[model samples]
Target: MSGPVYFVSGIDTGIGKTFATGYLAKLWSEHGKKVITQKLIQTGNVDISEDIQQHREIMGMGWFPEDMTKLTMPEIFTYPASPHLATKIDAREIDFQKIADATLQLAEKYDVVLLEGAGGLMVPLTTELLTIDYIAQKKFPVILVSSGRLGSINHTLLSLEALKIRGLPLYALAYNLNDESQDAIISKDTSEYLKTYLAQNFPNAQWIDIPVVQHKDPLMD
Candidate 1:
């Protein structure tokens, strides 16, 4: 049987999505689950995916065979922008089939695959397709990455509404502790408000706390 693939997205860019994904992968692996991470589409790089590299560093497993074979990073663009703009600038369209095939390959061997997206849910993968649209098509449950930074409540709720509108399954909301606001009151209140909102709206969804850590790659200087 094929394993489940969870799409990891954030409320906004720089909200610690990559960190959350790596943390979850490491946590699940420690608890004895064969977990692997996949970058849905990597931007701002050529030949190698920095996000995937960071994930390995955080997981402390270096690189997997799949990563070496490019199965985990199927699509990469040269420009540091959303997929649509990056694809436009690179004069190439995203090969959706290749990505799907890669995910299928990873799911076949791993217990769970954490597929991380480029940015927020509404980020466009193409002129006609948004990130959330691809998630709906693949039917992958979401593990949204959020934090207690200022304006997080509005962003998180809006992201949640988009999922609700599409009837998507929210597997969990990964609260990143590394990106919290400097003001303690704001951070604490944001946490409580989001928790109550999740309880009322997505009652079955899990709340995962992603702790702060310094991920250093032993191989890198």
Candidate 2:
């Protein structure tokens, strides 16, 4: 049997989706589960995906064999932009079948696969296909990365509504502590409000807190 693949997406760009994914992979692996992470479509790089490198750094593990083989980063575009625009700029189209095949290959080996998306749910992988549309197509449970930053409530709710409209299962809401609002008041309230909202709405989903940590000096006191 294949392992479960959790689609990790954020409310907006730079919302710590990469960090949340790495944290979860490390956490689950520490608990004895074989975990691996894959980038759906990497942009802004060539020959390697910087996001995958960050994930490995955050997880404190060296590169995996899949990374060297390009299985973890199946599709890479050279431009630093959304997949649709990046693909256009690079004069290439995303090979969805290759990505699916890679994911299947990883699933066959790992106990869990954390597939990280390029951006928010609304981000277009192609002009006609949104990131969330791909998630729906794969029928993967989502792990939405959110933070207590300002406007999170609105953005998070909108994302939830889109998932609900498509009948997608939310596996967890990974709250990114590292990206919280600077104002303590707003940050605390945002967390409280979202927790209550999540409990009342998606009772089965887990609330995962991705803590802030200095990746560079992890061993420093």
Candidate 3:
């Protein structure tokens, strides 16, 4: 399926979803595939989209200018919190149907559209809809990004279970090198455990350990 859309969701928040999406998108673009990225909703930034900007900077995405609000970032809330709470605090209502329409339009234009969700799969887009609900509705394959930390195993397993219950396709599992403060031994063990477990169970899913990239282009740094 050309121009496929993958919803890059995390087992939990702050799992490097933005970096992972940008890194993967850059690789696909380098291979001559026209890839575009979008952040479903953004909070914590008042002026510009720091997450989308980082994706563009890292991927050298110059197709859309900063003025293109709906393309790069469909929704924005000044409060740095969940989409539902943030939208409420900002006194704004989110029209999920409109958001879905915009996303489909972008997908029609590119070989791939990597969507970065605000937080976890269960993250509330509104009081009624969740991030996972949208992915399930769209039937988009999911790329779950988990932080390789002490409790990552339980978190990843739970996340996988949630996706399974929703009948969402688990396309890939990405382990981000978490903070060094986490016991490296536990992190190593967790990765090995998930590798074997996922392979034996979900044989079709790809298990990847993403390197910690410090900058946009590692060569430039």
Q: Per-candidate TM vs. native?
A: 0.96, 0.96, 0.90
Give per-residue lDDT, candidate 2, residue 183.
Answer: 99
Tell me which residue pairs clash in candidate 1: none
RMSD to truth, every model: 2.5, 2.8, 3.2
Q: Stretches of candidate 2 above 4 Å error?
A: 215-221
RMSD of 3: 3.2
- Preferred candidate (TM-score higher): 1 or 3: 1
Residue pairs whose backbone atoms clash in candidate 3: 3-111
Q: Candidate 1's residue-wise lDDT over 33-144, tens digit each?
A: 9999999999999988899998898888888999999999999999999999999999999999999999999999999999999999999999999999999999999999
True lDDT of residue 219, candidate 2: 19
Cα distance off (Å), candidate 3, residue 153:
0.6
Model 1 misplaced stretches (Cα beyond 4 Å): 215-221
- Candidate 3 lDDT over 1-221, as tens digits, reads 44789899988777778888887889889999988888888897786667887887778766474227566687778999999999999898986776677787788888888888988999998899888888888899999998667677887899899888988888899777633226778777878888988998678998766677665343211
CA deviation > 4 Å runs, candidate 3: 63-69, 178-182, 215-221
